[model samples]
Target chain A: MTAIAGKQPNYKVAPPKSGMTIKQQALINSIIVNAIVILLVLLWTIPTFGLLVSSFRPRDLITSSGWWTAFVTAFQSGAWTLDNYRSVLFADAMGSAFLNSMLVTIPSTVIPITIAAFAAYAIAWLEFPGRKAFFLVLVGLMVVPLQMSLQPLFSLYQATGLNGTFLGIWLAHTGFGLPLATYLLFGYISSLPVDLIEAARVDGATPMLTFTRLVLPLSTPAIAAFAIFQFLWVWNDLLVALVFLGTRADVAVLTTRLSELVASRGQAWHVLTAGAFVTMIMPLVVFFSLQRFFVRGLMAGSVKG
Target chain B: MRSVQLNGGPVMALFEKTWFRVLVSLVMIMALSYGFMVSTEFMKNQDAPRAMLAIVAILVGVLGIWALYLTVDNLVSTFPIRIRDFVRPFVFIAPAAIILGVFIIYPTIRTTWLSFFISRRGTGVVPGSFGLQNYVSLFTDPATFRALINNALWLVFVPSFSVSIGLIIAILVDRIRWEKFAKSLIFLPMAISFVGAGVIWRFIYFRATFGAQIGLLNAIVELFGGSPQGWLRIEPWNNFFLIVIMVWLQTGYAMVILSSAVKGVPGELLEAARIDGAGEVRIFFQVIIPFIMGTIVTVTTTITILVLKVFDIVFVMTSGNFNTNVIANVMYQQMFVQGNFGRGSAAAVILFIAVIPVMVHNVRSLKSRRF
Candidate 1:
């Protein structure tokens, strides 16, 4: 538990000479890496970019003209509409469905994080009865495919009468989200200095106070990082939402909307594209906002090897 | 109870109090039981087909959670200490337990039962015989056979390539000056929702352009003087191509994790190896790999689990037809499309079993992580 006093091992990757103007060399190196990476990003983005542009084009243009021609046809081919967004968000049951997605995602993300943070704290610091077993259960539960649990859960829900509801989907998501959340947070919280918590407890701080005042605050980088993770996961998730929420239009989430956007046969291309974008947006927001916390060394050598 | 210290001992008498951990555990059990009870109402009214039942269940689950407060009071009385000290973690975890019990555990048991029931379609065989007919059909039907092969192909290839590419990229990027930015750009694909990635790649793999081709792969193919290919319709080859999207999306995630582990590899170890005349490749294979083997396994198994449950890309791309059907997508087809709950449950059960081993392995390594 002592601070991992070990320094980073030395290596032969030579630093530039003492007077070699390292700033210019570092700049050159970074630019080379950035250029290559920017190229990769373009390769990754262009196709999706094309799809997003195409989704806005008129249906005929979507089927015919390349999305690139939007620039050339700027003078004459004026066809872009909110119709797809309108249909995706406000379609017969979709407005309510969007609301339903919010309900499911919010509670799902919140519940797991709350519990995982606490359990993670306990696992990390609190010496308690059944700690190892409880930790093991969380770890073991991580791998149980939700699909396997679906039937058992459905019948249980049916018996209890919750087979299809916003709450059902929320709980399902929270359940699935917990294991990873606990593992991640526990991994972070455990690495924190023990003396800080011990010292506070010596000063008569309650566990809740300690968590709020010390553990939680110190764990902000981890909590934010995990929130982004859980939010993205629950947002993009379809299976649990589909199973627990059923196909009820009022309760269908964005993923369910994307799923249902397909006609009885496949080919609902127009709406599917819009629906995909809708689901992508929230996660993108969460990702960009919390993206900074995912920086490495959050817990560098908190534990010695 | 008076003799107990203020700080809790690891093995404190769990059953010493009349209603200690058991009481809180019971309250948790009922709250979850109630959540399952209430949520079905949302599915029921003609306008709200299942609303009342869902409401009652959730209310019972959520509001009734106050029972734990009673247990908290019990602990405070018996011990004269704030039971919130003991109960708070359990409280934080209660919601997750309730959700899991209702939505996952309950339904899983239900699906297992449904797998024994007969299909409503009554097309394939005499529906269900409460036997293993659905499962037998999985190995028997040519379509099912192809689906299994396709899934197997995915299982075999996706993780192998994703890990390899991820490792390669991680190693390459680790050596770069702008490590974080480069990794972020590579990880960008991961942030695109899986459904969006499908749509994204669909455009790249778009086929048969009479007038204008916007699809990048095909555009490049044309640029190289080759005819545009039907990327998703390339029969046996199509499956691998479809899996490439998963690799592209996941590689960055694997890279981020692996790169951290790689960074954790003592710089001295690699130097020590080089001192012994080991080349970069040799050092990578020797010292670097052994050090990160645990993380590598965890990442690989986690990806294995993901690949096992893959339905989104397949559903988005081909709707599991034209040689891309996985168990999850195919199950969705049976349950929703065919309205045959029995067959779908079987497919889901199969998917569940397929994931269990990798899932188990993943969890074990996760708990035992050295870093």
Candidate 2:
């Protein structure tokens, strides 16, 4: 949301009118920029790449030699194996944890979008009583530290019989997610031309009809953006799942499970690597596939408000 | 589903009246409650077959809400336009309000209340009698003091390093040939969970047997003829090692945002600076930096809040061991692990108080932007 509200940066390369000396200077500048960019890129990527390479290497080699050494004819030396993935997937029940992550993420993502779409539309277009006050509160709630809510919410869950259930975690995620979702969607929906909604109303379309038919379709970009953000967030979350759902194997999401593996199996780098990879795969897919929307969502959050 | 028309014959017209529609709304609400019950029960006992049932139950619950909406909409449609105008927005905002109030707002108040009272294990707060003993102990305890100091260190270091590196990379990468590809690499760490990043960097800092250091940093140390050291076991430095993971994760976010801001700087300004015989370094600091200062502040503020609540990395990496405890981790340990709900609530209240000024500033900025 912040990114979207900012002016789109001009990406055109400026051509210089210069003599031979200036041309050489430009070349030197380009060379320096390229060197620094390459160095930083490698610096950022090598750690994760090393972890990925270690995920494939045998446990003995992972603990015995640095992962970089495996890059030299790693496969040719027969240092690679599928055993880590197999053991993590089967023996450690990470496969079920992956499914559990999906189960927690899908409804958590969907319910918020559904609820926020309506709320955002109303805040954006309708002249309801206390509209500004309500919008202000929502915006303010965006920065509330979620740690404050954990203990009481956990206790409340016990009273309501929602504890340790998927429904409880889903509700927690939705509540935590709503402020920003509503805020981002409100930005997009509010910016939609008044003429369109007025035109729909001038016809015989009811408010619900207008929202379902016009607002929902028109707000897909915002919806897709929030969807991707929420999906990655819910899928990758460790804290909420740990607190609300507890660490029971059947209920543990991928992150909680992987963290538990780290705690209980601290020396098992092979399994940890593979398990980490397993948990990472979904968010990575969502991120890469929906990268444009994801970045848009980030920019939209700050720039709009 | 849309084919069902309420505007039909006399009998249908009678059913479409406000009273009949009100009955439908009530029934739909009951249906939604029932669906929730079934779903919760299904999820609570998830086994092989029941897992599938749980998934189906979720779908049923969602559909039930949708059906409730349709029913409520038909009821609202039966109202006069003026009444509908006011009622419809309330209808739309009600579900979100209920959930947020129950989950976030109510808990916030409850936590504040719990902070004043004492907690008993296995049960919740004792409710009426209130005291400041929890807060008193929270501030005086050495562990908490260390945690506060560590949080201050994180607040200072993480944002500063992240913003500076991000600014440097963003400035450097813009003139390169593979700008998008390189920026993507820098931004890649933001995609990994903090837990995952912790594991990745743990490998980077791994220490093996003497003379056979396996971690990249330790290996590099050994290659320089220095002996290997346990990176995470060392106090103060271990905190720095953990901070490195956060810097790695956040720099990409800062870079991507700042890169766009840098690109937004007008070309003429840079050209004018260059014509005045300014070097690139001076152009960057004096001309370019000043232009994008707002975005730089925005990025810094964003990372500042993140550093404040940074629990996942510390939780996963050191579990606050070796003097790495921060406020959020300490709060969590007190609340859940130690079952000191009163103290945990106090810690949480402290965190909430810390966040209020930032959020208020954010809201004011947003309001100013609107006009």
What lDDT does each candidate get? 0.68, 0.83
TM-score of chain B of each: 0.75, 0.91
The CAPRI category of model 1 is acceptable
lDDT of 1 at B200: 74
Q: Per-residue lDDT of A1-305 in model 2, one digit per residue for the tens?
A: 32542354423434445655545867877887788788888899899888888899988888777788887866586689999999998899998888788888888988888888889988887778888888888988888888878987887888878788887888889889989899889988988888999999999787788898999899899898888778877887888999999899888888999889989987688998898888888867766787778777655553211
Candidate 1: stretches off by over 4 Å = A1-39, A56-60, A69-97, A117-131, A159-161, A188-220, A264-272, A294-305, B1-132, B175-178, B208-210, B222-229, B265-291, B335-343, B359-371
Least accurate 10 contiguous residues by lDDT in model 1 chain B: B37-46
Candidate 1 lDDT by residue in tens digits, A49-113:
77778777766676676677776776674577667777767763556666666666666666567
Task: Write candidate 1's Cα lDDT for B1-371 as tens digits.
Answer: 34455545654655465566557566666765565444434433335534453444445444444344334434443443455456555644555456556545566677787787675643533433779877888779888788988999888998888888788777777766677777776777777767678767776787744765657678778888998888888898889888989988878778888888998988667656765667678888988888999988877776777788888888777877787778878787877677677888899888877766665665576568643
Q: Considering every candidate listed, which one attains the maximal lDDT?
A: 2
Give candidate 1's error at residue A186 in angstroms: 4.0
> DockQ: which candidate is best?
2
DockQ list for all candidates: 0.31, 0.46
